[model samples]
Target chain A: MGGSTVEPVVRESVGSAPGNLAIASLARTLRCVECGHETRLEVHQSCPACLGPLAVTYDLSTLRGSVPSDRLSGRPRSIGRFAELLPPLSLPWSARLDLETTPLRPAPRLAEWLGVETVWLKDDTVLPTGSFKDRPASVAVAFAAAQGHRAVGCASTGNLAAATARAAVRASLPCFVFVPAGLPDSKLDPVRQFGGQIVEVEGPYDVANRVANLAAEAAGIGVVNITLRPYYTEGSKTLALETFEALGWNPPDAIALPLGSGALLAATERAISQLREIGWIPSGPGPALLGSQPDGCAPIADAFDAGSDEIVPVEHPRTIAESLAIGDPGSGYEALRAIRASRGAADSPTSEEVIAAIRALARTEGIWVEPAAGTVIATLRRLREAGTVRRQDRVVAFLTGAGWKISHAVALSRVGSAPIHLDPVHPDLSQLHVGPRPEALGGAE
Target chain B: MTTLVLASVLRQSAPSLHQKEYDGFRGSLLEFLNTVSAEGGPSFRGRIFDGDRLRRYLNVFVDGTDVRYLSGLATPITPTSRVDLIPAVAGG
Candidate 1:
């Protein structure tokens, strides 16, 4: 029951100044990862001081009063509406496509099935790329373009490449996507549709990631996950911000999130702290944060058990949830700190649980989800059964991506009917297999 | 033709071990471990030539068990042995 404790909440301010590009311009400055030394952003992905990854700094105070409830109503429908909360975007708003603001629906049936009250789904499947990666990819690409970087790339399992391709194509930035060949075609099709330069690496997800650092440095390409990480990660904060605002400004008792690279979980925790500090929302009882990962690649979960902050790297990722297939997460340490600080728990469910959860969501909630989302929902069920989440708790189960995105896994679930061999004339009979089977067929047999 | 290879995995069921170095794996093992360290996430401060400082939950397995049980990094390797870096697949 002992989890993260509430610490003194601090809010970094982004000064309020219209037409004052100070906050936006400062994005070019890069801070050292190891020593936190501030300097000009490096062309190579490596930090000049210790070869560490560089993070972008933001003027959060300027954004303090910039975002109001109705501010986004008339603005473009995307994460940019909360632009004041993010790194300043240099490109014209139209040049950068808006891909946020999807349907965040309440999953009452799923909640009832899990026996938890007030469950909400941050349905990101409606996103242009059908994954939460679009939130970060859009911001990262825009930041990269603003910095005058032409080409962009990323090492992806499946979702990141699709999101990056959509962002890159819209921005006219030629994109190169490196992925492990083991990825299913359903996830690959969207990337190619966006004209991405796809490269299939021989090894696992980690092996495909090798080219990003060098290319980001040598070619000055904006590798979203690498060079633009600081700004890119800011995109995930919107999920927390929007979720709280949407729920009548009331934070949930617990947030169940999918953990892969750990950016989403870390950002959500940061956003909650930031909102509480600004007085926009009163901070009293902190919500419990729980992270879900596939039992196959759960380095953070493993480290937590060992009571170690250091993350172990897994050679191979063997999970149906390919999007969450990151064997090693750069932000794993920060994720651990945040989860512990929030007094939250971590769960890694087996592939069987992941599959079963996926079926349950579609059946009860009519919301189909990919394996990562299934992992969260499934773990939420397990926790409920274990009494980790009480029946009275206000729980929100994050459905990160659409079931349509990872149709392969859904097909494997076998809960849905197999392809019917009906001819064009018999299309009406497709529904015949549903409900009670017609006695006519039985009698004919 | 022949090169030293090492593989290790961390699991509760088995202790860590490093076996004898074998042929045709020196290049692949080194590349896998080194590249896997940075891009795969978890930064190890020590230089590759200096030696490996495996992260907290990291388990290097030559065939099945961890290298800690066999000989740490000094575990012997042979061509027939397979090396693997097992991620901590921890969950209840």
Candidate 2:
């Protein structure tokens, strides 16, 4: 019930400025995802004609043979590195938040454990906001500022709130964030630190989102994920772009990612297709885009498994992975289409499996990630066991968030009890069994 | 008469439909929408539906269950049932 009391910003009817030559040449039109209606690029949520989500359509002919390897390498390591492919902005690369070029480290130990030829972990956990949402938030906040909006906001589960708050601070814009009541304090602390006006809705995330959308519409405030989504979602394409660049411009055979709202997977597929269309990548099949979700609230996976085009929303979502607990994913239909288009699969693992994966990834690859990332690791194991992913194929699993934030969830799963009370002055050595050192026990050393 | 709840965002466009009653209305969701459209007039109709189908971003629920998972446009509504119209919420 704790809501912001700030006066609503007056609605600014800023029509789409005639885009710069660079943007106008590449971005052709905004196409409706449901009804295929085309319109000019403007500040609006869904299609005016059909109320379906609007997606950007580009004139790829302008990019033909334009982006050479040197062009990409010469640019600064940021989301704007592939400026030719992304939505054009007047802001310079240096002014933008540095969120791209995350390290894609090869995990030989993980590969060996999984009996695979090669495995690479795209470490997005090291992002500025400690999650991949920073990429999208950067683009969205910049777009909002460029459109002459003085403030920006969003409805977030956790990561997006932090990402949006940080990006808003970078852009020097007032930020408001609406989050579900009772979100983990660890996730909420960063938003407060970033100077965002936090509004906690007394309901699930969906209800909060609805409240945000209404506020945005009535107040004319730019809600990044709602009003500026067409431009905001474009930022996620950088994930695929960065991955290809790190792999020497060669697409992986398969890539696994956690499925929340399904925007990241949809954007990754678009990135791959756009790269191929622009002749940046060779003409061939792109990576199989595998998606994973927690079994408790896996509407997309359930739809995929049922072989249905319709995504049935879960009335109530229950899972340890709060980040991936989106019962009704906004991009569910598009995500399913991308998965099928790439001949990919979707899996939903149980809470126990996810916990095991979180431990396994930390032990094997030295990467600590939140439970959402664990969904991908667990799904990859399932895919390998099902023979859908071959031993010879190169796989990349995206680790999306930092584990330190969700350390409590991990400890609860691992220890299954409260901490043992011990007196520091007179500690019992029997309870803490000391083991022989590895070097002393082994003969080879 | 069924009790209808419109999301706060949709109130401006269809204020007449907000917690308004439709006495003796009985049929599928489509039929109910048609009745509301007739009573509220053209602007309300256009905002809530595109022809016979609900707008893509708008979701309808009968007694807390999404109509899409039920019978879609044909999902029936009782006189005592409460209906909710909400926009598709974004997730990350």
Candidate 3:
């Protein structure tokens, strides 16, 4: 639980720099979810009271119409496009990592297959680091650099490791990533390529996370998911923001997201709530938030099904959806609250179902996502079948990571038309297999 | 006497701190925390409470369940109750 080049930073600024927003301008402050205590913008903090998590709140009380005030007219189409509603950031030009806007594509084929009226795929596979983690990493790294922290780091399974490391490298700060020992080199190499000093903690991801927290706190390094989470997580709300904007400011009937720490789903809920309050989105009954998880590691889904608020942590998660293998999701409570608030439900899909959905998406929508997103597609099927998500409902499923991240898992499973190694010298039509497409993408071609 | 335990980074506030016996202690968990805060030191005290509210980062578990699920700080604790003051640790 340690690193090199530690330094102390000090911001003694007190609660909410208010009144600046009451003038009908954009003013922001950090507020405690457990206790409504407001605090001024600073680095390395949580709610001073109750030890609950803190989140940024914007005073959109006087704001009207659309979200980002025409100020983004000439800006690059990145996360920064909607910076008005976000906390003020100062990412130096030399150390900038622009988070490009991912596609919210029409998935007519998927919609037809699911028997739904419309299906929109919010594909984040094209994002930096090939995952949605880059959105938060960019903000967290920038926030830390602005706050004068000497270094940045995070405890990650794989995605966040690369995301945080790349962002850190861009910020020119020394980066440390704590990951469980024994992860494949294919995963660790991505983070290492960014020059992130990888610290292989000899334990599970949870243990590595704890060690990272202790080490980051000691080294004065802003651990993206720990000390810098308020700002870090704020960056993810844009997932909803971007989608809603892409949909012409119209909220969908329902949205499904892969749930792990449950942070992304919770953040989407936050974005929806904010937009609704500001009258940007028509108030009554916004999109239902569907949380998806792998069956082997679905504490949030389990709690939702049992009609309980308690998240019985999955002590030993066993799932091919490695990114979704968070046994003790910190945001489980928050995600559940969102699901219930929207009258949505949480569900898990088996590894087999997940794999099937992945191939289905690939063959149908031409999108290949990691197993985490596959679980969401699988859950969408269940929800549609159970009448939870009606046939006529417009559904948007989040495909957050690239398929290559878990291509190894897919390779192990019985996937797509068998590989036909043809003898080039005497290649025959029999050797070449271009048979009719399977009814479902997973079965024999 | 109730057993009060502080966990994670919060334990740094009082290094010698461990299971404390609270005998004949009255009032809410917040009130008891006021006493614990005084013992932990002023800086630690400020981090744990903001007047009547517990800081957002700390979770007080009574008998192994988070007080947030209970009646919050008002969740009653008898002399035999076991209270755990655990900091909110991030996952992922």
CA error at residue A344 for candidate 2, angstroms: 0.5
Q: Per-candidate DockQ versus the true complex?
A: 0.05, 0.38, 0.27
Q: Which candidate is the best by DockQ?
A: 2
**TM per model?**
0.75, 0.84, 0.81
The candidate with the higher DockQ, 1 or 2, is 2
**Which parts of model 1 have CA positions greater than 4 angstroms off?**
A1-36, A39-55, A62-67, A70-74, A93-95, A416-445, B1-92
What lDDT is reached at residue A428 by model 1? Answer: 65
TM-score of chain B of each: 0.45, 0.87, 0.83
> On residues B1-92, what C-alpha lDDT tens digit does candidate 2 reach at each position?
79887755466676777889777667988888787778767776776786667876787878766787689989998887778776673546
Q: TM-score ranking from best to worst?
A: 2, 3, 1
Taking the tens digit of each residue's C-alpha lDDT, what string does model 1 give over A74-122?
Answer: 4444565555566666545323555557766877777777888778888
Task: lDDT for model 1, please.
Answer: 0.67
Report how far off residue A197 is in candidate 1 (Å).
0.7
Strongest candidate by lDDT:
2
Model 3 chain A lowest lDDT segment of ten:
A16-25
